[model samples]
Target: MSQSVAARPRSLWRDRNFLTMWSGQALSQFGEQITGLAIPVLAVLLLHATEFEVGLLNAAGVAAFLVVGLPAGAWIDRMRKRHVMIWADAVRAVALATVPVLWWLGWLDIWHLIAVALVFGIATVFFDVSYQSIVPSLVPAAQIPEANGKLESTQQLAGIAGPAIGGWLIGILTAPLAVLATVGTYIASFIALCLTRDTEVVAPRDEHEPLLRSIGEGLRWVFGNRYLRRIVGTTGVSNLFSTISFTMLPIFILRDLGLSPEAMGVIFSLGAIGGLLGAMATPHIVRWIGEGRAIPVSAIGFSVIGLFLPVAALAPAVAFPLLVAQSFVASFTVLLYNIVQVSFRQRITPKRLLGRMNASVRFCVWGVMPLAALAAGGLGAWLGVVPTMWIGAIGGLVSAAFVVFGPFWAMRELPAALEEADADASR
Candidate 1:
């Protein structure tokens, strides 16, 4: 029996439900990559948007994380996560499809783009929260790490191809037309998710439970733990400043640097290679340094590398390579930190609280993005691009202190809770 058990391959490859989700996610991520570039490109090049206008557009895309993120988590825990995912995908497809239509009608404006982004972002909050929460239901505890790596690896691959494709498509068909391509990818994802089978066993809940109470429970659970709370604070602070810097990229790169769409695509695609390598190398890094130690190291490394973004402005001739280099190193470090922390969080949380847990985390880490986008717009206008970037670079560096001085420095193994859960799953 032991030999037979050992002979069988232990992998998620044989799990149809997991495969279905992965396939859909891969396609969706590819389309999202296009949207990531296309929208900003459209707002910058086509609409001739200023720094403040671009910041508003960027802010719209992420504001939902703060507005509806908490409630979405509470609702997700009470419903089938897969069902929520399918609906969210469908909504995103519909919302994105409008960009091309409005443009064709000569009605496209920055406001239209912002409105679409806001709606799409709202759906994304639900989809993303459910997506992460559903993973435990798809695979066992021991498989969580492998599943995260695979998912992150493929997402990075999409990051590699999506920008290049989006740029080429924008050059040939125009920015609005490029959106249609993203719409198609989302439709494909919607169909794939419709076919996915979910095995989540919903826990009994009082239907009358106040949504605020549920949200509060998740909030308390995440905040009650010192380690988790610090991680949240670190990520939240880092993301705020990172957005301040990134919000200026489209304006500065296209206008100040005079780079073409094709060059822009190549830069982003090549830069994402760092994330791919990081995801692939995460297991090895964790094994060598352990999770707790890796967190602070990765966090500090990325923050330090982020300073390079501003350095590129000093020498215009080498700006392109410098920009790509900064992106590469930053992405690599963020991925290593993210995959390790996410897998650790997944393993430790109980199944019933996964939705709220993931949601609460997102609320802290991602919630700052929109606010930062607005801040980026104002600061970019007031302080000028390089000065604002300097502010972000300096501010972001401080986030590393949270992990470097926290409890994880001494934690070389899983806490007792996660270890017990892993043992239970093996049986």
Candidate 2:
């Protein structure tokens, strides 16, 4: 263990390749957050879209996970991840830039926005699958937790600035011009990716293998493993309910509460600080409580905090603080859950299977988001926003039971290696 520890890279900050990749991803994540706010606000304000339309728009943006997620993993496994990422970024940049250009031409419409969201989401699916697959090669296995923590921290930090700035931009420049910021960020991300170099060679694969067979291999590997199966259940259920709540959050905050765009931005920004804190604390928490234990605890904690969202509807004065508190605590626990889970997935999976494994996991986790958004939208349209949120929050709280009752909760510690875990399982 000592020798293994000694062989690991001590500091990610000192590595130029990692830094370049991290910088590009940081900018890209921040850009995504900006668009996240700007797009929905644009739909509501400029297009005068109904709650169901807004939900549909959000669903369209993430629908690619269900569309191309499986094949993307198989295809990416056969190519250089860095090159795939670079092209993905370039494509997304061009796609997003069209939005602002069309708006400036006074030809922007809901269909145009929908087209852009779908195209951008397709690029994002490739980028995300490649990104997760490449990280383990960039750092040693022992350092994965630290690396993931740092990456999560960067994401949280971007979440802090992105929405707040997006909100302010939307307030001053309106939603159309606000999207231009993401265009610049994507361009910057492209440049950052261009500067980095990947030292690892692409993993070898059979040239004649059928694509369907390759995809099936990934699916079998993920579902065949007990640990991953439980993770899928936990993540899928939680994401389903979380998306339901968030799908209508814009209407609740901006329309129902009558909050200004800037104020709404501030609320989200302040809430993201909890995520940053969680990232900073993860390594210590893992050491203290063990990784296996942390998962259920975080999941349950997040659910408990989520209960506050529906309660926040009592009054405007009561709503602001309670909503902020809910966001803060929920973000914190979610980050903690994600950091450990992602690290564990990376650590356990072999290099040749990383892309497929990540993709399969995402397929289960994110594919449900669009469905949940549509459900929430339909419910919000029929039952009203607050009632929809109530169902979402309660459903999310209950989903934690999947983890609490699963194999993960029974283990005191995660196995040190996948082979050892497999051996124990077989015995």
Candidate 3:
């Protein structure tokens, strides 16, 4: 025990390769923030793109997930994840770099932005899947939760910091110039990944394997697990409603409450701080409540806390405070639930199937987001944003019930991967 305690100083923080990869991702996350905000602003402000065209641009960005969400996983399983990530970053960097050059030459148009969005998004799908799959290979098994927590924490930090930096860039230079600034971060990510030594040399997958069959195998593995199936159901439903309500949020704040755009931004920023706090709290909460119990309990919280958003109409005097409080708690619960379940899923899945497993999860959960957004628009128009939000909150309760009343409540720890399954993907 004494020796074990002494040896604990050796961690992923001390690993040069891990540090290199993390630094690269950190730069990418921070830099990417400027462009995400700048791109749409550029279309509306400089390109003179109409509202419909801007909508098309936003739609094109996420359409790739619905297009390749499942197959990307199968393809990722066939190659090295680290290599996939490197290429994704490189492609995004190159695509973003084109914007300023095109603008300078007077060749840039709304179509140019749309094209960039499509390519950037496609690359994002690959990068997101690859990074999640690769983490298990990057560190010791015991450190995976810690690694996830750190990564998530950095992402939230980026979320907070990204907007501030993006806002600063916009004030100093135009949105296109801000986008140009983001290109460096992606370049840094590519370089960091290139410099980091990745040991994984994936075994040859049957090139002749029917693509659909490979996809099916991944879907089967995820849904076959009792815990995973419920997790999928829980997250998918939660996302579905969450999107439904959140899509109409700005309208509620700006139009209904009569707040300024800056005030609205402040509300979201303040709310988002909860996610950062939740990431830091994850490891401690998991230990205190036990992983299995922690998940369902957190699930209950977000939906219940979310009710405050719509219900705030009852007390308009304090509605702003209520909405801010709702966002903070909901962000906390949502982030905590995600980290716990993501780490849980990574620990229990086979390495060969990591790509497919993550892909399938993304496929199921993300597929509904666009649809939910469309639904929110329709419902917000038909029934008003407040009533639609109430509907979404109610739906959240139903989603939470999947795990809140299930076996996880009585359980302590989540299951480890079966010993036989641990040997290989063949299981």
Candidate No. with top lDDT: 1
TM-score of 2: 0.95
What's model 3's TM-score?
Answer: 0.87
lDDT per residue as tens, model 3, 286-310? 8898889988989999978878878
Candidate 2: residue 303 lDDT (0-100):
79
Off by over 4 Å in 2: 1-8, 204-208, 421-427
The residue pairs that clash in candidate 1, if any, are none
Task: Give the count of colliding residue pairs in each prediction.
Answer: 0, 0, 0
Model 1 is weakest, by summed lDDT over 10 consecutive residues, at 418-427
Candidate-wise lDDT, in order? 0.88, 0.86, 0.81
**Model 3: lowest-lDDT 10 consecutive positions:** 418-427
* Residue-wise C-alpha lDDT for candidate 1, range 1-427, written one tens digit per residue: 8988976646788888889889989999999999888998999999988889989999999999999899889999999999999899889999999999999999999999999989999999999999898888888777888999999999999989989998999999998989888888888888888888877987667553688998998887787667677789889999999999999988878888999887888889998999999999998988998878989989998889888888889999999999999888987899999898888778787877788999999988899999999999999889888888888899999999999998788977656485554453344
lDDT (10s digit) by residue, model 2, range 50-89:
8888788888888999889999998888888888999999
| TM-scores of all predicted structures | 0.95, 0.95, 0.87
